[model samples]
Target: MIFNRKFGAPGLQRKKLAIISTYNENCGNASYTHVLKVAFSEIFDVDVIPLDLFLLQKPQPFINIHADAHIKSICAKLKNYDYVNIQFEAGLYGATAGAILRRMKWLIDAAPNLILTMHRVDVAETTSLIEAIGKSVRALRAGPLFHHFRNKEFSVLYHNIVLHCKEQSARKNVWIKVHAKREHRVIRDVFRFKNVIHYPLAFLNKEEQKKVKALPKADLAARFGLPQGSKLFGVFGYISNYKGIETAIKTVAQLPTDWHLVIAGSQHPQSIKAYKDVDPYLESILNLIANEDAERERKLAKLARVNHYLEKTEVVDERLTKPITDRIKFIGSLDDDDFVHVLRDIDAVVLPYIEVGQSMSGVIVLAMEAGGRVLGANNLSFAETRKYFGDTFERFDIGNHIELAQRLQAEPLEVEAARTAIFETYNIRNSVALQAQVFEGTYKNV
Candidate 1:
């Protein structure tokens, strides 16, 4: 009786797809789910089953009780769907690994055909014994048993999740989807999960693409209230220490006076304090700028004293210092429309994220899609992304501001390799077609 938009009356009896994710929230996963829900709805009878983050992330003793009840309710709705996909990130399910795994198992059992899209895969590109030893030392100093066992515990949970998916594939139908090739290789080659597939994230839908207009650089600078001739470098997304924003600041400090940094995101809601005080990370950034200003003042005062002692017309070195804070700007968080426009208009998009085992970055994809020059940290995720997106962006070592500054100062990318790759290969239409194949069991990994 229901008419499908893509197909006519009767509509080939559109298959049902239930996406299990955190919807109605300002989370990145929620945004991704929303995009997919709209796109998939044209072909399938789609439903978004919201994940209760509050209950799942409850503190201590009450967590287990509430989490179980919450998951049970979700499992009850999933049985009828032709295909169910969970946006898996581990931490979103529960505070502890055991709690997360138990709930995941319940969902696996409930769905006839399940697909797990892993947003974060804890496996490293390569293991280092020295890194393990360093963590152990830090754990000892921190005096917490949780810190000591955290890495090992996550490793166990990751393997168990993959194995569970593999086991489920044997009986009926189960698939594991990852955002990057690195994660796919790890699951298929490292953990030996045969059902794993790679699907790069699709950022700009039709509406979003329409919003992205390539404004002149002068107009963009005036809009953001910056010097007309200043070179603007920007970092987007929620403010977090892992974003490696400090490295960007340091890089700008080493650049020419005309070069400036624009931080275009505000503090994450989770990072906000109860009393409305700035979070520790945000405070650290402010203090760093303040300290730079004070250091400049101190040098100026010292120079003044030296000038007083010297003869009136003595030749002085032309080098002078100014407050670094003046060159930096915080434009705060932007809505979806402005985000794409600003990303396109900026001189370069800098991604200085430190490795936290992230499999996907929506910002990076969006940046590339907007046709901007992207400079990313040489972390595993970005390195893998370059390989996946056809070597689209330039890379600098993580936390090495000197290297980053040098890269930015050099010629901007005249060619948009990543953008071309995204448009021609990893795009929204292709992504939907691939998922359709997946749902029909006709998908093949090439």
Candidate 2:
């Protein structure tokens, strides 16, 4: 389905740029789409098409079979655009692959200059034939009669299809470039695609940057009801088991009373329930909250444990799993204005991601752009992230609660200076201009 919004003057020259993503209009995905749309509009006329591939006409025993049909329909329509930019992610085995393959086929068949943004491809996840077959059966029963395919077999098939698409595009002299540098490097070394161009993902406008910059740290602290003198540590983005929210909580539990942690993302209700079920300490906290005397004692005990961990650098695993009592506050999901407000008050941003791939980190980039110190996980992707920040950010081992606590306690001057350098290197204006340059160069070559 296509929805067109014509803005600005009618006579202005606008290059037709098609952005394709399967993301539902959720906040995180919407934020990404919004940024890209703004950036692309600044450079050319942009059309943002969100393909609804999962919608089934009828309820059935399994997943919807018409998913591939929706993808093919979207692709066939994309032939109208001057350039097609596909956002590729390695998430679902069956549906995602079908969508990607259909879109890729359009790139090959229609021969539009294609720019594939490799977002977290090559990431491994659990899969089984039974699961795939079940989903497939559900889809088949839903109408459109798509067959069930095995997960492992589908994955191999998808990878080969992508590789073949790249090769065929190159053979046809079509411009097919990739966005992520590290992923591009690996793909080049393995698949040897001559048409691949390594372009880093970037942020949006200067107006947005200015708005974020104008927010005051003191005002943000006041808004959040945090102590005026307390140092604030922030964890931004969607909370998941692998994103290391637990580690941040543990690190906060180990910090001095002057340090407060603000977890700014909405909790995944499923993951929270799962965590509570597995951790007795979490269950205990929930149980104790009902009784006045017991709750008071439990709160004190939790505070004492936090204090002890801070004083002795001892392990704080059990205390970390307990739900937020006082020191850690859940800010829930923040709008752009509110997010900037919170960032203004934050002393540092902590990214304790367990997994890393070709994906870009908005939180890390935003914190640096807003002049907040960052402490990120030491991963291959972060190594590249560090180049953008230079000395402004610190890297700690993925799950090192103790080290994170120490860094939080240390001075922030050096980190702030490093952040300034990062801002110079990765400022949205420069990054977007660089992307425009890449697009122009690719177009000229084609």
Best candidate, lDDT: 1
Off by over 4 Å in 2: 1-12, 22-24, 53-63, 92-111, 123-158, 171-180, 205-207, 218-222, 225-228, 267-324, 356-358, 413-446
180: Cα error in model 1, Å: 1.6
Whole-model lDDT per candidate:
0.79, 0.59
Deviation (Å) of 49 in candidate 1: 1.4
| CA lDDT, candidate 2, residue 258 | 65
Query: Per-residue lDDT of 102-152 in model 2, one digit per residue for the tens?
Result: 545654565365666655545222545566557757776522223223334
Per-model TM-score, in order, reads 0.87, 0.71
Per-residue lDDT tens digits for candidate 1, residues 63-148, read 67978998999899887889898989787888788998999988888888888888877663244556656766886754234443
Model 2, position 312: C-alpha lDDT score:
58
Q: Return model 1's CA RMSD, one decimal.
A: 4.1
